[model samples]
Target: MESGNTITIACAASKRTSLHGLDNIAAEGSEGYDNLINLVEDLHSMNVINSEESKELTNSIISKLKEEFNKDLDDSIIKIENWGAHIVRTINQDSWRLERLGSLLQGQGIIIMDWAMKFLPQRFREKQTD
Candidate 1:
């Protein structure tokens, strides 16, 4: 499969995995915010939604959860860096895929790397270079 298709498939698979977690988390009262964040991050990483869409969805969910629990919940914005980290984590988890993707990108590796590096956590970036 082409690299772009591979990425899409990987991202879709990741989303499916996360959605299962989300289903479980959603059952708990007021304790699922973190999982919600992960869902949003995964959605954004998958390109299934844009930043604005993520933000809107987050706010909507938070509102619903608050109404259900009749308690205040912290509003969250879509963290692009977290999304970046999620993508990196996904890639790192499969070394063979990373190699294939790198080869697929070819001359564009530097540009993609530069963009990804900017948003990755400092600790992750440090570990990568070590």
Candidate 2:
């Protein structure tokens, strides 16, 4: 398989494994992974961006959640950098496939915007108070 396909398959497998783990955690009465699971589910629900692109996004989100969980500043910054570059490369491919990809990404974009609306202002306010 292509490297991209490998990453996609790996991501899907990892997501499944993590979610199953989260289910066990939930059964044990902890809700630590709920937000992460919700984010992954959102990515899974999207039909745009093929398996590879979806995996890229899913990995990015998982990395973000990892940063939140572990407070790994350096790794999280690297993930953010790579995520932006990957997105730019995808948008710049200038192909019919990407045009279709954009349509699917539009939905995900809206979700991001909603999150930004909720998250950014609260963060800004907290900074202001400090």
Candidate 3:
């Protein structure tokens, strides 16, 4: 939750769209939520990040469905300013964890490329290939 906490897109949200499963749920309240949860949880439990389904999901399925839903369903990525560089406020000397988001902070030259939002995992492979 930083300056723009718009990254959070939950199905139950009114103004925001859920990041996972793309189901039309405007008035179907309970049922819609249920379906969304099931879809999300099922996908989360899967090792499908690099699987074909995931690529198809982002490139075709989700892209097409997005245009179809329009508004009723809030499953779209909102328009907001995302700083090219993440914010790293502090550093954990004891833990290997990155305290915030501005590089290695310690200047250890550790590059943690986060492609989690990217539709293709091949992007990561290509980066490493370079």
Candidate 4:
């Protein structure tokens, strides 16, 4: 296994996270992360966890997310998948045109995709810039 560190979810939250360069986090994973895991374990011992578990439960969830990401990363269309690919894929799969989508992002300044858009009432998608 690679050197995996225990990245504390608390330290990663919006309130606690460094606002500077928030766009770029985690360039790559490193080794010698057992120490990090120990640190996270200490956090858990302090009683910090979700309703579903007593401990914060890091490794298993991290592993599962990594597995899902590996599949996406290996995909031919978007190796290092990003927003642009996501836009293209949605259009290709839904038989949507770029112009129609542009109206959502450019005109509205926000693009709500897939399931998240379903909950949005028409009022949420009202008149936009030209």
Candidate 5:
């Protein structure tokens, strides 16, 4: 029937959209992870953080990001009857966690980068003034 065909088409479209959404999230997370790594490495280079501490911080962040990404992907899958209702329910349940994880990464990246920038420059200035 035409209605059945239309329903199938809509479902397919929704699925594609969902996949694209997940891809977007993955890309954003990847960028955040990269920024975190760069910030830590820069701190190490500036002697602001030692090698062991930098290594541990980097590994912990990478692991947490991977875990969160997998969890978010799993959570976003549509498995129930009503597509709209299911999406709403998933968003209500999971969006806060996802947003929090993202904000944590983003916020930390900004904070660390700011501190590293200032700390290194201030140290250089102190040396010159000495």
Candidate 6:
């Protein structure tokens, strides 16, 4: 029926949009991760944090980011259902990870937190309310 075809088309379009969103999040996270690493290296070079401390801090932050966001994103992409509403949910989770990372860096007195904030996606830069 025409209605059935219409529904199918609508669902397909929705899925495409979800996939696009996931791709965007993945790209943004990748870029943010790279920027954070560079900031760590810069801090070390400037004698802000020692070499050992730099390595430790970078590893700790990256490990948590992977454990919290990347793993979930990968798992979700493998499931069909995840291409729908799950994408929307995971996007929020991914953004939250970035915000949480910013807070963590600030708590550690990392002076580059402001520079690091610049790399976060614009949507994330906007304040969110619970």
lDDT of 5: 0.65
Structural similarity to truth (TM-score) of each candidate:
0.30, 0.23, 0.23, 0.22, 0.41, 0.40
Task: Name the candidate, 3 or 4, with the larger lDDT value.
Answer: 4
Candidate 3 C-alpha lDDT tens digits along 61-111: 455545656753343333222221222212233134444444455755655
Question: Residue by residue across 37-112, what tens digits does model 4's lDDT show?
Answer: 5556666677675434623456655675578557744773454457678788877866655556656754465354
Q: RMSD, model 1, all Cα superposed?
A: 19.9
Which residue runs of candidate 5 sit more than 4 Å off their true CA positions?
Answer: 1-19, 22-26, 79-130
Clashes of 2: 0
**Model 6 C-alpha lDDT versus the unseen true structure:** 0.64
- Candidate 2 lDDT trough over 10 residues, lowest sum: 23-32
Tens-place lDDT digits, model 6, residues 2-91: 345665344433322254445645555555666688899999999999999999989987897679576766776777565777688768
RMSD vs true structure, all candidates? 19.9, 23.3, 19.8, 13.7, 25.2, 24.6
Work out how many backbone clashes candidate 6 has.
0
lDDT on C-alpha atoms for all candidate structures:
0.59, 0.54, 0.44, 0.49, 0.65, 0.64
**Winning model by TM-score:** 5
Q: How many residue pairs clash in each candidate?
A: 0, 0, 3, 2, 0, 0
Question: Which candidate ranks first by lDDT, i.e. highest?
Answer: 5
- Sliding window of 10 residues with minimal summed lDDT for model 1: 69-78
Can you write out model 5's per-residue Cα lDDT over 1-130, one digit (the tens) per residue? Answer: 1345665344433322344444644555565666688899999999999999999999998899779867866776543336788679768756765665677744363222344446776867764224
Off by over 4 Å in 6: 1-22, 81-130
Which pairs clash (backbone N, Cα, C closer than 3 Å) in model 6?
Answer: none
